[model samples]
Target chain A: AQRVTQPEKLLSVFKGAPVELKCNYSYSGSPELFWYVQYSRQRLQLLLRHISRESIKGFTADLNKGETSFHLKKPFAQEEDSAMYYCALSYSGGGADGLTFGKGTHLIIQP
Target chain B: DAGVTQSPTHLIKTRGQHVTLRCSPISGHKSVSWYQQVLGQGPQFIFQYYEKEERGRGNFPDRFSARQFPNYSSELNVNALLLGDSALYLCASSFGTASYEQYFGPGTRLTVT
Candidate 1:
């Protein structure tokens, strides 16, 4: 079974500081990875996907096949960046399947 | 365009009772998926539907069931609910199957007493 692991349950960073949310996955085949975020009282939304390779809201993640990791990164964290972040994976990468999600990390940006 | 939407934003039910949650996908989306999010935990996959047909399902018990409509909307029904069933139920929609990025709904909070 494919499983996503997000080691940190909470992460705190100062404004303008760099932030990295760790995410590692265990899947046998090529998998599609994504980062989803939920703001306070807001619905969950997609932050970015590895296949796109494009940054959203100054956040970027690179899929490392060798290490089976897809860590989210931002050079400068902003106070508004505080939210819950989830790392999700789709094992088949092709079929209409549900994503397996990590427990999520609560990101707190202190001003 | 509207994102995925769920109805009955919040609900409370007693144990052994049944409940139904509804979801409407984005205007052009054809695939819908359901998930359960417990407190302090990640969302767990429940079911996936595309083109009014069942495509995939997660490791859930038979008490959990869902169906897609011809219009692409979907409904999740849980039978004989337990206290453990209390959680936030999420609905996601996409243009295609798992190959496409899924858009999530605001989620319906269900509490089983």
Candidate 2:
């Protein structure tokens, strides 16, 4: 079975502090991991994907296949970074069938 | 161009009633997918339609159905609604079947009494 787990339901950090949201997945094949964020009064949007290997809004995530983890990290957290984040995974089949999502983590950046 | 759009931002219905939620995909997008997001939970895939054909469906009952028009717009219909059916119905659209990035709408909040 394919599953994504976000252990923390809520996380809080002071501004300018580093932030890390943990995510783990269970899948048999190569997985495509993604980070999605939802801001207040805004629709859910893509934050970054592990395959892209590019940073978005100063946030980055690395896919560690050995541990089956794709953790999202930011060197310094900002108040605006407080939002609900979700971790998603897609198989390498190159289609819509592979996408699976985690429960979600709420990050609170306290000023 | 506008992003994905869903109609009736909020709706109220009773149990055993039927309701239809409409969605318009982003301009030039050919694939549309529907998801159900309950309170305090992540969204769950309901249906995926590309080129007016049903490509995939999640673990939902037949009481839930959907159709996509030639213009790529879509509608989701739920019949014999149960109290558990109350949720936020989200619509997402992408340019092609292979496009991994999907734009989502604000979603329609359905309240079943």
Candidate 3:
């Protein structure tokens, strides 16, 4: 069975502190991972994807295949960054199927 | 351009009643998917449609059904709704099947009594 696990339900940090949200997955095939964020009173939006290896809003995630982990990291947390974050995984079939998501983690950045 | 849109931002229903939620995909998008998100939980996939055909479905029960029109918009229908069915139903659209980036709508909050 394919599953994505985000152990931390809530993570709180100071405005200038570094943050890390851990995510791990169990799948038999190559995985395409993504990080999505939902701000208060706003729609859920894509924050970044492992395939692009690009950072959004100073946030970056590195996929460690050996560890089966894709942890999102930021050098400094901002007050506006406080939101619910989810980690999603999709198979490499290039099809509409194969996307699975984790339960999500709530990050609270304090001023 | 307008993002994905869902109708009936909020709905209240009673047990044993049936309900239909509508969604309009983003323009130029050919793929649409439906998900159910309970409070404090991640969105669970319900169905995926491409070119007006069912491409994939999640592990939901038969009580849940959906269809896509020629224009690529879709609707999700639930029969004999149960109290546990209350959730935030979300609709997402993408350019194509391979597009991993899914734009999500604000979602419809369904409350079952």
Compared with the true structure, all predictions reach lDDT values of: 0.94, 0.90, 0.91
lDDT of 2 by residue, B49-78 (tens): 999998878789999999999899999999
TM-scores of the first chain across all predictions? 0.98, 0.96, 0.96
Q: After superposition, how far is residue B35 of candidate 3 from its true place, in Å?
A: 0.3
Q: Interface root-mean-square deviation for each candidate? A: 1.6, 1.9, 1.7
Please report how far candidate 1 places residue A17 from its true position, in Å.
0.7
Candidate 3 lDDT by residue in tens digits, A1-111: 778999999999999999999999998888889898999999988899898999899999999999999999999899999999999888755477736789899999999
lDDT of 1 by residue, B43-78 (tens): 999999999998999999999999999999999999
Native interface contacts kept by each candidate, as a fraction: 0.80, 0.34, 0.56
Q: Give the winner by lDDT: 2 or 3.
A: 3
What stretches of model 3 exceed 4 Å from their correct place? A92-94
- What's the residue-level lDDT of B33 in candidate 1? 94
The number of the candidate with the highest lDDT is: 1
DockQ of candidate 3, scored on C-alphas against the true complex (2 decimals): 0.66
